[model samples]
Target chain A: MSEFEIIRDIFAPLTATAPGAFNLVDDAALLEQQNLVVTKDLLVAGVHFLAKDPLDLVARKLIRANLSDLAAKGAKPLGYFLGCVWPKHTDRASIEQFARGLAEDQERYRIGLYGGDTTVHSTKTGPLTLSATFLGTPPKQGMIPRSGASLGDDLYVSGTIGDAGLGLAALRKEFKFTTVDKASLSSRYHLPEPRLTLGTALAGLATAAIDVSDGLIADAGHIARACGLRAEIDAVAIPRSAGAASWVAAQENRWRALATLASFGDDYEILFAAPPAMRRSITVASKASRTEVARIGTLSRGEGVLFLDEAGRPIPVEKPGFNHFT
Target chain B: MSEFEIIRDIFAPLTATAPGAFNLVDDAALLEQQNLVVTKDLLVAGVHFLAKDPLDLVARKLIRANLSDLAAKGAKPLGYFLGCVWPKHTDRASIEQFARGLAEDQERYRIGLYGGDTTVHSTKTGPLTLSATFLGTPPKQGMIPRSGASLGDDLYVSGTIGDAGLGLAALRKEFKFTTVDKASLSSRYHLPEPRLTLGTALAGLATAAIDVSDGLIADAGHIARACGLRAEIDAVAIPRSAGAASWVAAQENRWRALATLASFGDDYEILFAAPPAMRRSITVASKASRTEVARIGTLSRGEGVLFLDEAGRPIPVEKPGFNHFT
Candidate 1:
């Protein structure tokens, strides 16, 4: 699997950054003469993915996670470098399947494999750890960081929240789901749509932006702290997919369920803030990118991410996002 | 150690790719408008280094390993992205030590931590796996890959070889060594001096070049195949340190010991080939870099690599380098 004999064949062809990269025959890869965006993510098996998860899906998840960071920053994908640490049991067939996933995404995203390293650890007995260092071009409006939000800016989020978290819960048998429901929820957890076009379109308009890898409340808190503003997200205004809506509708305490759903992580949608004056521009960006953006609330001269019910009453949050330490 | 709480303190200041990186507050880092070089290397404990190895040494080795690749391509250090998967037992002190190592090396080589991701992997039971994606600017002469070796070119290698392999063997107790000997060999094994200046100097002078991460003979073979030429390495001309020299001298069968040492990977020295006409330039490069370059071989019109004894006879290679399966 991770043996050099087969991996060499798979890796060599992937190194197609010619002219500058020297087809990766050279030790390093070359970057464009522009302000390149660099981001990295570490995905550990058992933590990032299930052991039974297809290698192809795992590969896609890895690429998409890093790509999501770029999209959040209003950057365009250029290329990426991968580093994988394989366990002893990994074989050539497994590696080939993983490459197939990467190949599919590379074609879809129009990114090349600049260079990478694949190492085999014979003594490793746990889940494999994989990482990617993604490179890209900055948006015309430059980088949109979380620390740019301002007071009175309207907070908006793209796509539906809580679907991924519910999907994971269903997968773990914490809840029941129909065949169609399972597919929709699991796929949401597996394949996150990195809002590249929407993020790019919002580059000049959105004051601050972040991809919702963590839970909505938690990530909003990051933007809030960075800009020294309070993010007041109206829970009733939070968008939800049909599947998520139906799931929550079945619960007796619907608002509580909504709160629970929004608090779970893994939604790779764009959450951003923009002044009310840019509402027209924001609508234009959403229409042009064909992505929906819902106005949740506004930033105030306060601290942390605050949630409000329909009556505008503050709702206390016990947990914000995923924490490594339980 | 990998906890986001304390890690926040360590990671924020390391985002020295300022003005573009947004002080690690942004989702990504930005590069300058130059011919950028990108390379990544995965270092796994118990595989790339000893599990008991000091964290500082581990950090230096990781940075140097990636830097070595860039050096081979005639690239100067710029910045790097780090992806670290921490096992359960790691903690704040360990991460601090690791950061200190990176800080020391960042000062040693002019590079910065552009961005990085650190994740807690409680399931991982093996030695930590740390990966770095290094970015650099190529020399004005451009990148020198393995595919440019011309016929009748002189083969040159920087520093010494086999010391790493021997050092590993000595560490494994396969060979005995005194305190001075052990320190010299282990340091060579742990701390590889990337031939940055020499490689930049060799950019135009050398026809092709590669860093000796794999064994010297094996890497020479790569250039041979890339250039469609045969490499004839005079084994006796291969350089050695005083410690290695004395160890080999003490052996009953010095050639066997030499072969073993040469075949051991991890010697991050530069091995290059250039036309004899560029002797003056090569000499000037050596002088400027203050690094010794030894002519150990020649390129001939043929295929693969051939090792020659003092008598100019071909010596068979049973195992050219380290194979993961073995």
Candidate 2:
């Protein structure tokens, strides 16, 4: 079964009593009374990232992934609880390096490490597994749920959409890249910049929002399916970093290249939907937050996500997004 | 390095700005203004439990472990966030079974499920790893910190000790056991009864508190070290279940046998410190909460913990508790 099916069939019932949990469908759980948003994310080496990646970058990625959830909910992070299952024979120096990563991010995000557990795996070859639970205070207007999107809503994405995917590809040597571009792409994969400012700024403006972690088309599909609407994206309007654009230009089939980019996960950009009338307000908020925003699509009375070409032809996508189960 | 040393040397400094984190020394981190207590724990298969343990019991144990931390802080559980890294090829039925276990405990504890992450390891040989972050409301009088114990304070522990360790032993077939005893011991190891009621009841009455997870003596040592005092325990006063008592009776060296019991972790009982004057009040609280409490030790102006015999002679203990890193 897919992750969604597992969550819907098995875990959703567990949240029956928690109205704020949004039936396990939202990006983060809401504590409505306190205007608090809570989110947890797990990352295992060899699955989420290369096992040989720097411990510092691994630590930062763990924190950023959860922060992106809170960001999507328009929440200001307060602190986080961490759980680390260190591989056996893990030296104190390696742990200190991980701590240094957390320390650097704590300073960057202005959040503290509340408390957590650290245990070493019993076997020498066990992979490093990490989990983080982040708590945040939501904007005064409250959190934006992914299911809040309305039909005829215009979708906007913060920053670039496919840079992280390109970065991963570059790291894997799937394609050649300039020294600077390779470093930049690798950094994008290793460390995500959570759109906290834009998320908070769009709080009262955006009808619904979600972070692009599970690929743009897939996450946009999440909002689309959540609100019972079809997210119709103008494929040409999908923003990409220069490196990603160049990479796409080099591909034999531009449409398939674009599809691959849209289907790749790890972009921590906020994907939001708002009524067409709110476009001006979103632009103003975007500028005020100093974040780049691109109008990518519109929510229509249909189902799932649809990527259209410049000629208004619907492009076929074999896989809409990243599914861990697959 | 020991878990305590890892926390102190590597993690504590990260909590410098979060006063409520108690420098990573306390069981649960406090959110003072919200009267909230939060804790996170990670359990890995083959390390924390046998790999073949029931999924339901594993789920319950993960929740109960975090609940125990909240209980130690005199807090009433509100909800929990979970992170499950299921072993590869995990079936729908297995996950459903795990959910059922969580469902049972959620009803028993009257706590709602918050939000969390669920992922599958990429490797078939990967051990299942689970994490939980529990949040709760502290008692009206506020939390009972581990560092609150004072000199001349009497130390108390709720419920029986050593059963969990013996239960694990029985499961491993380390010794012979009656069918009834084996089942009882196995249940104790799988399902620890968190002393929540007793902990909250001791709010204003107890000076300091900690859950007996890393053995009674080690937990007592935690409170002692936190408060710059020494704990002196009467070995004979340590309470034990009938199964544990019979096992101790069968041992040739009673002193070493008793020491083994005191050093066995996973008790999940609350160990607390209180003034001698509150002895009668404690009995009232204990009875009202329907939890058995034994005054087994006292704090003095010294360091570490000392276990004494009936003649008041200190009995040497090689290892006082379970250390994950060791």
Candidate 3:
């Protein structure tokens, strides 16, 4: 099938059942309701993923990355706009698989492929780039902004952290692992499950929220800066996956490995904060969604992120979060 | 002065003044509004533009392309999401200039820069690719869908056509031009004025509307297919710029050139159809807005687009419109 055919047959079918599916063929899609929450992300082939990675996984990754942003704001996705650039020698099968993956994710998120533009290049060295814009409805109480955290609010995380980071290390073959460890690590890297349920549930309950695209400490730092409050993370409370522990145990630079795992980007887990009084209710909601909820830290009356041991001793780092420029 | 810095300093400031400008430092900006319209466009360097094109113009072109989509639906742009891919050797100055241009267009359009992603590639063979997603609001009466046209509706165009195509020809050195001709043509190529005012006014009046991106005839064909009606255009009634007649007079392939101009894309003008009863009101509205509106065709109980001479004879062409796949 041609690229257009692939998009029409696979991706198009997935969009048929979306909320605002009527105008998919138009230049833009119209939402039925008035209020909206929108976000976008760009994924470049080499920088964001290896060219040799499975095309289906790459497509899924792209969707998940954007969905994570929506989840952070406690928004339910309505539709997505896609922009794709194809390489010269891109085969029909590859495009078909990519479309199939996109279709799968669209159905999973209940989002229509509203409208987008596609272009092809003659050069082989150019990496394919996929940009997705996610549209959704903000909660009635208003979205949980990164800047809404309050001093003395409890820090919480939905789902285990560092799996995606460790998964990346395993993918690069920089670390060796057993069969189960390999499967767990690879799954983390290839299929990041955004905490959409937790995000939507925490809309009114959480004081502040952000998806852990960067490492836990770094993402928390974003909340701190935005809220004009210092965040203190109890390092001992960070939840690590089964494989992550094994990987760290085998490392001579255990502390460094743990820190890297804590700082590595691509974990789609939601890290949020709320009043200490609301912690029990937040945990109940998280459990109802079948996602783990842990109190990892607290917001303080200061700036930046402060990491502490169980005894509340400060842990120093060069920086708290990932800087794209650096 | 890195790419991120340019985004933070230049583009961020322009978007700051608009509503829903959230944490630019986050993975995505959260937009809170009712009724969102989302559209995206991808522009590849060599494919959509020349490598040596001014950075400012490139940025403006990217924004205009997206804004034009919103204009077609009578949607007021709320914000934009940009996805940029730069070459490895690209310096901060070029990116900063591009950001400045982006800021200029954002302020002009009264839209914010919500969020986007950026990446750098190693190959010089790959042209820079910029993708923009525009979030907008539908008019109170709702968006004018391309499929809403009815039989016996009068077809209208907001502005003169074919300037951009001619501008492109001038840019490729395929045509020689006088200083005035060069300025006019280059302006058309570099900056497309989207008919936002006309589109907004057309919300309740026009049966259906679409932006004339793929030439008048081809775009008319889209309306015909969507609304299940035949659209017939009177070639003699179609408005043209002063340079159009001169260029046609100078060309040996006058008929071909005229046909080419009629099928040229990037006009960013609105093409709509309305009942005879709304004709007088539409004219009044057009006059009030100071946007030119010409009645160039009529919709009939048939399918496809028919181009006719003054005597009603059909004008034949090998291709009706430009296809992205083709």
Candidate 4:
């Protein structure tokens, strides 16, 4: 079958008249209301993930990456748009597997597969590219914009930092891990879950929030700049994985490993800020969700991001975050 | 600066509030209302267009291609999401030019730039990949779904067809064209204008509508299959450019040329069905909008698409439309 025929056969049966479902073949999809939240993310094979990565894992990662953005602002997933460039060498079975993974992820998120495009090219060297645009509803009160952080607000992260980063490092052979640690680390790299529940819970409580796609320090800098406030992170308080302490203890280059933990991307954790008064409520909600929460720093009156060591000395770093252009 | 820094500098300053914008940075963009119209399109370098295609035209095509979906449903433009993969060797100026083109096109459509991702890849041979998700508001009464066509409904197209496809053929040296024809054909290839105005106007009148991304016969076939009916089109009634007619007349291959026109994609015109009674209103609206309107066919109580010559003889053809998978 041709590309068009395949799409029609696969997607036509999946089509149904949902209340807000757009005419899928139309020029654009229509939303029911005026208040809309949209986000887009692109995943390139090799850079974003290996070409040999499991289709299921790739599908999950793509959705999680986009959902992580929604989690940062406490938005509800409405639906998504997927654009795929299928490699010429990919067989029908592989395509089916990919589609199945996509369907699974969509159901998991309760998001409709509103529309998308798929194209095939003859080029042998192009990476498989998948881009997803997620549509969500803002919080009832409003959204937690990146610009909402205020001076003196407590900075918190929904889960431990650097696990995903460390996972990548391990994947790259920068470090070796025990069998148990290897499984855990690989899971972190393959399926970093978005903290949706905690983010939604903190929507009104958190002054500002952002998903940590780049490293914690780098992403925190985004919040700081957006809100025009300085962020001061205490390195000592930065949460580590269960095995991180042991690994660091055995490492000759402890500082280097620690720094790597703070600089790696792919950590789909939500980093947010809130006033001290909201700490109790945050803790309560965190407990209710059975999710970890930690205060690693504070937003201050200055600008830019600063990391303080145990002795309160500022640590100088070459770069704060992942640079896509570089 | 690195890719990350480039994104920060280019997009950070533009960060305001896309509350309803469904931006990229958030977990998901919120849609204010329901009955959303959503669509996605992917553009791959080499396959879709040449690598050296002007950045402005590339950006315009991205928006226009997606916008065409809205036009098919008689919907209005709302916003869009962009997913881009920057070639590893791409310079800052190229990126800026691309962004500038996008900005201009977004402004033209009154569509907000909600969110998107920028990634760099190691693949050296793949053409730049770009994808866009367009969100639109369904017509007040509702969408003219492709499945809504009824027997005896009149078929119509918003504008001339086959120009873009012919342009491609011309570019490949498969055909020759006069200078005037070449310019017109190339323009059709480079910049397809989505029939937003006509689509909106036809919202109530068109019982079913679809953008003619694929050639007329193929796209019309979509309506036929969707509505579980057959389409009988009068070939002479199909619109054509002046050069197209001349070429056909000169080569005595009018049927072949017409079939090619019927099977090509990227026209971005609306092919719609309307009840016979609504003809007057549609004609008036088309006149007011200064866009040509032609009655090319009728819906029949059958399956498949059929093309008829002046004597009502069926024309033999191998394919009805461009199929993506094949």
Whole-model lDDT values for every prediction: 0.84, 0.81, 0.80, 0.78
Better of 1 and 2 by lDDT: 1
DockQ leader: 1
Interface DockQ of each model = 0.64, 0.19, 0.50, 0.62
Q: Rank the candidates by TM-score, best first.
A: 1, 4, 3, 2
Q: Tell me the spans in candidate 1 whose CA falls farther than 4 Å from its real position.
A: A1-8, A15-19, B1-4, B124-126
Estimate the TM-score for candidate 2.
0.89
Q: How does model 1 score on DockQ?
A: 0.64
**What residue pairs are clashing in model 1?**
A1-A91, A1-A92, B1-B91, B1-B92
User: Predictions ranked by lDDT, top down?
Assistant: 1, 2, 3, 4
lDDT of 4 by residue, A21-71 (tens): 443443344455456567888988888887888886898898889889888
Better of 1 and 4 by lDDT: 1
Q: A1-326 in candidate 1: lDDT tens per residue?
A: 32445545786676564345566566677776777878998888877777788999999999998898888889999878888887776877888899999988988988888877777776748467899988888887787877887789999999999998988888898888888988899899888888899988988888898888879998898789789989999998999998898899899987788788779888999999999999999999999999999999899998987788888887877777887645
Best candidate per TM-score, number?
Answer: 1
List, residue by residue over A1-326, the lDDT tens digit for candidate 2. 23234334433443444444445432223232353566788999878988989988998998899889888888898777678898877766677677778777877888766656677788876789999988788788967777788889999999887888888888889889988888888899999999899989999888888899889998887788668899999988989888888888999989888888898899999999999999899999899999999999899998988899889898999887766654
lDDT of 3: 0.80
Model 4 misplaced stretches (Cα beyond 4 Å): A8-19, A22-30, B8-35
Please give the distance, in angstroms, between residue A253's alpha carbon in candidate 4 and its true position after superposition: 3.3
Report the lDDT tens digits of candidate 2 across residue range B52-82: 9999999899888888888887889877767
Taking the tens digit of each residue's C-alpha lDDT, what string does model 3 give over B172-273? 888888879878977888899988888888889998888888788888988887889899998867778888778878878655666777898888889899
Q: Between prediction 3 and prediction 4, which has the larger TM-score?
A: 4
